[model samples]
Target: RIAWLKNYAGIDYMVPDPQNPHARVINPVLLNITQGPPNVQPRPRQNLNILDHGQWRHLVVGVTALSHANKPSVTPVKVLSDKITKIYSDIRQFAKIA
Candidate 1:
């Protein structure tokens, strides 16, 4: 996934929504939640050169596929904020360059 991000950074990929489709760049928070190894804590998005720029305009997160049959839990606003914060912070140092 990181490799994919590296190749497509700053490009707005389509997010397939039923009613209204949207576009978003990949981010560490969404990557951790959807693609990280099972049961392992996801790492912070640091040293990732591609993630240093572009503001997130939408909330939709793109995933390769769903692994479980059960529905995902609803995320609280605070936790979601933290995740986004961490992701942005990890890439904050490179915001100017990206």
Candidate 2:
């Protein structure tokens, strides 16, 4: 599961919490529930034809197959904010070199 996330989502670290020795801290952007708009209903499983091949297949399959039941839950808003902050920081760093 950790390897799958690292390979497909570019998430290399799962921070360990000393306070909760059993918990693994993964970025919430990796969750299926955080991937789409809040107002829009998820496409039915029967309609996900795009997952059958190509890059989407790799990502979708890996994410869905991972065992998330034991992971801590995070609000979608928090996930969005974290993702935005990461992107902004990345862009700033890239701009410095280019």
Off by over 4 Å in 1: 1-55, 59-75
Residue-by-residue lDDT tens digits, candidate 1, 41-62: 5675434445433425232132
Pick out the ten consecutive residues of candidate 2 with the lowest summed lDDT: 63-72
Candidate 2: where are CA atoms >4 Å away?
1-4, 7-72, 96-98
lDDT against true structure, model 2: 0.48
Candidate 2 local lDDT, 1-98, one digit each (tens): 56755653445456555579899776444444455555565664334333234644454444433423223375544544454454446455544442
Model 1 root-mean-square deviation? 14.7
CA lDDT of each candidate?
A: 0.40, 0.48
After the best TM-score superposition of candidate 1, give how far the Cα of residue 4 lies from its true spot, in angstroms: 13
TM-score of each: 0.27, 0.28
TM-score of 1: 0.27
